[model samples]
Target: MENFIIYMAKASGLIAVFYLAYHILLKKETFFNSNRWFLLAGLFTAAALPLLVYTKTIWVDPVPMAETATRTVTLEQLIAYKQYQQQMAEKAAIEAAAISINWFDVIVGMYLTGVLLFSIRFVLDFLSIRRILSGNIVMKDGRFRLIDSEKARSPFSFFNYIVYNSAQLKQEELAGIIIHEKVHSSQKHSIDMMIGQLFCIVFWFNPLVWMYKRSISQNLEFIADAGAIQVMEDKQAYQKTLLKITVQPDCINLTNNFYQSLIKKRIVMLNKQQSKKLNSWKYAAVLPLLAVFMLLFQVETVAQEKQPAIELIKLPEAKVKFAVQIDKNTQDSELEESKQLLKDEYNADVKYENVTRNPEKEITAIKVTVKDKGQSQVYEVAGHQPIAPFTIEIEKNNSGRNVITFGNSIGKDNFVRAQAFRIDANGDLQDLANDSMHVQKHKIIIGSYGMDGDKMPLRSSVPLKVPEGHWSVNSLKIGDTDMLIVINGVKQKKGDAIKLPLGQEIAELNMVKAKEAKKKYG
Candidate 1:
């Protein structure tokens, strides 16, 4: 809806520009036929120019970073993170529900209402012309239909039908009026009037559109007057005939009325001398004006270049070991279970610092030391252990193989959760869960599964709060893999999803396996 409004605005601006140009350069010229076509061309160009957009891409040097580190999180830390996210989501939902009105929706409704009213007006005008033509045809021929009716106050032409009150005009006056109406019928000036009416209906709010329609009507009248004068013997008699017919109060909007309010201008144009052939060059000015508008509104510039890949640094070889020392009173089974728990859950060796005993002699609290390359960092735990901050450094070992090291942060704000993955030589993700050399294929799906109340879920990188029946995809990984993103059934190019700006909520989202995607999309 917003996009449509913007397009209308651009089109309206173009219409205004074209009309202003026409009024200044060619409106006074004795080029009625040329002016008629030029006005019609302006309407067409205004409607089409905004849609012809050109995208331009530019490349530039990437910013350099001194160092970069990935993050490795434990299962407990992941669970804690999810809980925190859920709390934040609930708080946001409460705040959103407190709001009462949406101003955007109100504005859209008002605009549509205006459009409806104007459309009805257009239809009424058409019907009015239709009713006047019915049962009033006095003569019918291949060239035109002649309608004699008391309902028509002044001489007017709509398409092939020319309407006039035969009893009110002298035979000589009728002859001149018929000639003018015939020109309108032959040239199909009513088609131009109807087109202008439609433009006015759609853009009823724009004063420029109303003026544009007037300009079209006036030029068409000028053309009809010129055509009438060429056939008549005395031009002054035709001018006098135009002056004799007073402008009617019941003039139909969709027809060419003989006695228009611009009667004085019509008389002036009738006496005006022929324009020079070279004055036709004024029409060429529209080309440059159109070019200027295209540059200002239709061109889109984008930066297409990406940052260079980071180079991995080499680190010294370090042997890591885990040992859980127990007292003579501790059972061998309990000791072995503790060692396995550290290996399976923590995925790292830890040194026990301060172990507190409960009333039953069981450990209640413990301060654990995690070591990386002989550098030890201690973290105290009570009942529930919060996520320990750590960073994973990517480097090469002595054998020139890629190595991933997990340890406490070496600098402030250096730690981040494991979100980055590197593609190996065989186009597989390196399995950080196991050895750095191990690679596997992974599938990741990110989308919303349901709506939040009446509101639809938005596709975003961050997590959002949804009701009980809904679930949004924050991030999901099955095996180790690259993702194929399809929005509204269209498969996007690599990195396009990240660059695309989403302004609307996601309506529906689905994920298909590689085999299914290939078969369905191909």
Candidate 2:
């Protein structure tokens, strides 16, 4: 919910910035088409800005444990590590306890309730407009539909349908009305209004959104007036028509009414001089503003840097691949499971070897080898631990290639698959199976990656119920190179990532956090 709120706030801020630019720099200009596009592109960009992800990478000194035994731990380093451990422990304790009603939940409840009510209103408004046009509409000149309504003193249009009281109008007034509504229809002004209507439904409480709707409507009117007056032999006659109908009540919200309140501005814009073509450069200013928004609102993932401090071997045009060999004495079930997981998840090739015929003899260390290399990388993992996964990142920044192999193994006896739960704003919890959309709809932030494939691990801020001492949730952070989320207890060897949005109404979530979780849940 917090993340969603921040996104909405940034979205509104961006829209407001664009609208200010339009109002200040482009509003008075006679470039109607350009202004229309500017407004539309600005609104869409603002909405999309929050969904874009950006990354940053920080390189620090290497650790000694992964390289050699001569490394001594510093006091400051130990203190920082202890503090992180304590913080994780404290977080786990708070989340694992039974939740109570809180103010944040109440606020979310109110906001969703408002969304529901406004959504219903939006749908009904559409139906009302449809019902009105369905009746009393006549096909006119085979170009548009005309609705003759006795009570409709002001002319209005929705798409190609025009409604007005023809009986109460003079031929000049009728002509002006048809010409005005034609501009609205031919230009598809109602499409802009529909977009506004949707924003109002989804972000009912956002004042800037309402302001944006008004801006779009006002811009559309400017366009329609500018186009309509061109067809008039007597421009004053059209201005008079606008004045005459300005007092009438507006039609349904979906329709572009001829009698909008901006009569003076419409007349002024109708006579405004054409703007200089070079002034279009003002739109360029929007780029930096959007960049700022991206930096502020992009979701990030933070990973504990746990790569063994081994010197990297740079192989130009050489692809370094990993192969794992399991001892032949391993149980068929465990070995096959590992093989299938490797094949299905990582697409890695696996081989089996037997040194002894005894089934009870424990398999000591799994040997990992870089293809074409003489010495194999010995990974010391217990029979109960899943083999660690590694990635080879080729850096473009003149830095040598890095081969990162995780030191911790995922314990099979303690292995837990990702679990999801449906939580509402009121702190209610129900078990769900990998529903991303549901989690998102409730304003929960799911961790995601930029250069993602179909089989990436799923992470969510929403906590899940897991046994003590296992990874809980996943989040993403941006880096110059693709980094992996390496934790102590659980190993990610295959398609263990969440790909799609969970499709349910989940308010809050719980994820498994391995080390700290062990103390509480265990």
In candidate 1, what are the lDDT values of residues 155-232, reduced to their tens digit? 899888999898888888899999999999999999999989888877888999999999999998899999998899
Give candidate 1 regions above 4 Å deviation. Answer: 62-80, 306-522
Question: What would the TM-score be for candidate 2 when compared with the true structure?
Answer: 0.53
Task: Give per-model CA RMSD.
Answer: 17.5, 22.8
Q: Each candidate's TM vs. the true structure? A: 0.62, 0.53
Q: How does model 1 score by TM-score?
A: 0.62
Clashes of each: 3, 30
**lDDT scores of the candidates, listed in order:** 0.63, 0.57
- Cα error, residue 88 of model 2, in Å, equals 14
Query: Who wins the TM-score comparison?
Result: 1
Q: lDDT for model 2, on a 0 to 1 scale?
A: 0.57
